[model samples]
Target: MHVVIVGAGEVGRAIAANLESSHDVVVIDQDGDIVDELTYSLDVLAIEGDGTEIATLQEAGVEEAGLVIACTDDDETNVVVCGAAKTKSDVFTIARVRRRTLLETWEGSQGAFGVDFMVCTDLLTAQTIFRISGLPSAQDVDMFAGGLVRMAEFEITSESPVAGLSVQEADRYDSLTFAGIFRDDEMVVAKGDSVMQAGDRVVVIGSPDSVSGFGDDIVTRTSNGLEEVVIVGASEIGFQAAREFEEHGYRPRLIEQDHDRAREVAEALPNTIVMESDATDTEFLAREHVDEADIVIAALDGDEKNLLVSLLAKRLGVDRTVAIIENLEYAELFETVGIDVAVNPREETAEEIVRFTRADYTEKVAMLEHDRAEVIEIEIGEDSALQGGTIAEATADLPEGVVIGAISRGGDLVTPRGTTVIEPGDHVVVFVDANVLDEVIEAI
Candidate 1:
């Protein structure tokens, strides 16, 4: 597959790196420095030209491209790039837009601006924050099989019950699979003999109910009174988070610095309380009893402002704090300092685009342990090589690190064992080693 990506920003660069190893990737940007840097850093083709122009699209091999992604900062430019790419060939086009109105208009119908798909950064980031904060224990969460199946990463604390238990010893759940563990920044493929330790991040896959129960069992913090939520800014991320919380039966209080913006958001969201005041004012926070809130979100536009406000909220005795940060380096710094979670919109968008470009086009994909492993879902066919065989027999010839996490047949979820049979039309979810991605795809 040939992929041509427009824009050399963080999102574009990330998408290129993800596809370079498996596909022929070409990147187009107006900045010569970024193009030169990408060429030197990655094994990809980089071109310096405006992506909205037809000549640039031709030079970037748009006519032969299987996928063309428009990801420039400007929404109009991205739309134009997609439209121009369509003129060159009948390629699959994906447009990245930030404006909600434009996205809604395009998403209502097909062939709108020649975009086959659209991705919104604010919406994706908000969804991520909502998932992690809603579960309150998983560092990362992704859904599959139409929300029936789930994958989550839980951090094992010293107070956790399974802290020192081996993988075999911690096999308490009937429908759960421990995919892998991250200990001391190293990826350890989980097995029966692998032992879990404190401060380790473990990835697990299973049904949603089973995964939620597993999280509750391992996390030290009680989820009894996580009813109150405080939002620091009325930015897009904050507003979307508040809305998500309300839909999930949580009434959030949103605070905005500007009076007009606060009034607008307050009107838009009937259930949310709109407070017009600076979040940095400790006296105001005390008057409002911010310390009693279960979680506080820092979503200001500036990274520095978000960091400072999160630190202050933590000091005020908030149990959990989530901050929206732009710089990848600062995300690590904020996590080390005190913030419970840091959400990066650019990285999330890039990940979603990469999922859409995979060769097999798996039902879903979740990157774990900094892209060292992946959890993928696919459906078995009637004439396939894996059908009609037991789970153990089907996977015996494959790599050692892969594990069949779950199997669903006719809406019935099955926790696979040695005797489980691989019937046709069953949706099988597997965790694969990053190094054996190509082999796994071929086998599937």
Candidate 2:
């Protein structure tokens, strides 16, 4: 299938990088330098033109594209591009937007922009921050099989009891499985004999309770008395994070640099306390007693401000810090520099939008380990080839790297074993590694 992508920004480049391996990808950008860079780096066609122009779409062969994704930095340009593409082709269209209002408008009005789907980076970023905040120990958290199952990554602290233990010894928690370990910038498969070293980032999959329990054991922190949550920005991402934490019953004190914006956020988020102050001011943060915060979120528009505020929050004795960073390069640096979790809106949205490009169109697909792996959720069909077979028989011919994380049938969740039978309508959640995703789906 041919895929045409507009805007050769970070998100567009990421999508092309992932899709160009299996599908023909054509990226459009006005900047000749970006186009030339993508052309030399990725195996995809790069065109220099305005994506919203009909001539540009034609030049990119939009009519022959199976999917057209408009992911420019400007939301209006993206919508217009997708809408214009509809005039030339019947291709499935997706538009990436930073504003949540556009998402609500198009969703409520039944696709007013001729967009088949809309991906909101702010909303995705907010959700990512909230997910990580709840599981303070995990560097990243993603859910599957409704809310029953979860996959989380955590850094093993030197004080962790299981830091030096083998995989078999660390597998003491029920319903939880250690998936992989990242040490010294390389990924190691988590076999029985694999020894978990300190500073290693470990991936775990299981029920939410089990994953949370395991997280608590690895990273030491007390969430009991630290009821205050300090938010270092009043940006859309920060506002959304405040609202989400409020829903989960957390007291969020939102600090905004703009006075009017603070008032607006305060009115909208009645459950939160909005204060006007400079997030980068250590004196101001000290006045707010940021040291008592259970979690501090750095969500300012500038990456430098977010990084500075997060470091200040930690210096003030905050238990955990989550930073919303736009630059993918800075994301890894944040974690390495002691930020609890780093959320990248562009990367999160890219991971989300990449799922729709898959051939099978599973119920959900999550990008893991910088798109090196995927956790896919697919519903079993009544006439499917896997319906009547046992788990062992069905997966016997499949590769060893794919692991069935969980199964859902009749609204009930099951941690499957070899004896477990595959039934029609069962939702199977599998963690796939490397390039075996296509083969795994084929076998199923």
Candidate 3:
């Protein structure tokens, strides 16, 4: 596949970096310096020109390209680029529109002006913040299928009732399972015998109703204390996150570097504590008892600063540390830096766009990150070759590092074992590591 990317900004760079490995990538930006910088560093073909211009897009081979991604910071520019691409060529276009108003609803045209998709970064980041703070006790919430199914991460406190329960005992709850347990710096997918101790961070996956039920159980079993949240950097993205947290009754202490910027943020929300200071400084964080905060969202401007703040927060004993990483290239490195979650607004926004633009033949092709891996969802068609076979039999000749994580049959979800059969119409979620995506798909 050939991919033409507009804008050389952070989001454009992220999309290029993500597709460069698997697709023939061409990146266009108005700035010559940015074009030159990316041309030398990335594998993408860099073009210095306006993407809205038909000639510039033609020079980048938009006519031959399969996917044209407009990721400029300006929503109008993105729309223009998408319009030009869709008007001139048959390429699938994804326009990045940060403002929620620009996105409107999904019921609109699919390609009125070549925009097959639209991504709203602000909405994506804000929704992520809302989910986390909505469940104060839970460390974080990972939503799947438009919040139809939810995955919640919670830290087991000393007073929690599940402190001494084994994995099997916890799974006794009708619609819940101990998905994964993070303890002592290692992640363990739970088994029947696995135990939940005081310091363990447990992840549970279920429906929204089930999640609420689970939350109720946690509140009764554990002490219901106020969860303090401090967000470093009051960027629009930061403010968006703070807004969600604030709405959920978690008072967010927003730390901004510039005084005027802090004042601007203060005008928006009266509840948020907008403090003017450098969040990267450990001394400032320490003085505020940042470690005592239940959760800290370190969403600063720079990737390095966010990483440093997240690591510091973790070192200071913050329960969960989420870092807003601007550069998708440094996403995996966040885990190494001790950040619990790395939020990439552009890529996440792009995902919504990509999902909207996905072709009929493709089951599910997710852009996991700039590098590393992707989670591809596969559904066994009625006429498919491996329609009624077990996962072991279906993937017998499959390539390496391909794992079938879960299988959804009708409305029921199951973790496939050796004997677990995958019938026709079962939605199978497969995690395909970077090296063997093509081979794994071919085998299936």
Task: Judging by TM-score against the true structure, name the best candidate.
Answer: 1
- Per-residue lDDT tens digits of candidate 1, residues 1-444? 899999989899988887888889999999999999999999899999999999999999999999999998888999999999999899999999877778789978867999999998888888888888766567789987777788898888888899899999998897898888888668888888999998888888898888888888886563474788998899988888888888888889999999889988999898999899999999999999998888888989899999999999989888789899888778778877978888888888888887888636587888775567888888988765567888778888787778888887888788888788888788888888888887887777
Candidate-wise lDDT, in order: 0.86, 0.85, 0.72
Where is model 2 more than 4 Å wrong at Cα?
A: 381-396, 418-424
Model 2, global lDDT: 0.85
All-Cα superposition RMSD per candidate: 1.8, 2.2, 6.2
Give candidate 3's TM-score: 0.69
TM-score of predicted structure 1: 0.95
lDDT of each residue in 1-444, candidate 3, tens digit only: 888888878777766765577679899999999989998899989999989999999999988988888888888888888888877787877888877656774326545455777777987887766666556456556655333455666767677777888877766565554556667555555667888887676766666676666765654422244477788998778888887777767678999998888999899977899889987678888898988887788878888888888888888888677888777768768865556667778767766555554444445555433324555566777765455777668767665555565567776666566577878777765656556766665555
Residue-level lDDT tens digits of model 2 in 289-377: 88878889998988998999888888888899988888889987898889978888998989888877763658888887677777788
> Which pairs clash (backbone N, Cα, C closer than 3 Å) in model 2?
none
TM-scores of the candidates are 0.95, 0.94, 0.69
Of 1 and 3, the candidate ahead on lDDT is 1
Worst 10 residues of 2 by lDDT: 219-228
What is the number of backbone collisions in each predicted candidate, taken in the order shown? 0, 0, 1
Model 2 residue 69 CA deviation in Å = 0.4
lDDT of 1: 0.86
Badly placed stretches (over 4 Å) of model 3 are: 8-10, 13-25, 29-48, 63-66, 86-92, 99-114, 128-142, 145-226, 246-251, 256-291, 303-317, 327-339, 347-370, 442-444
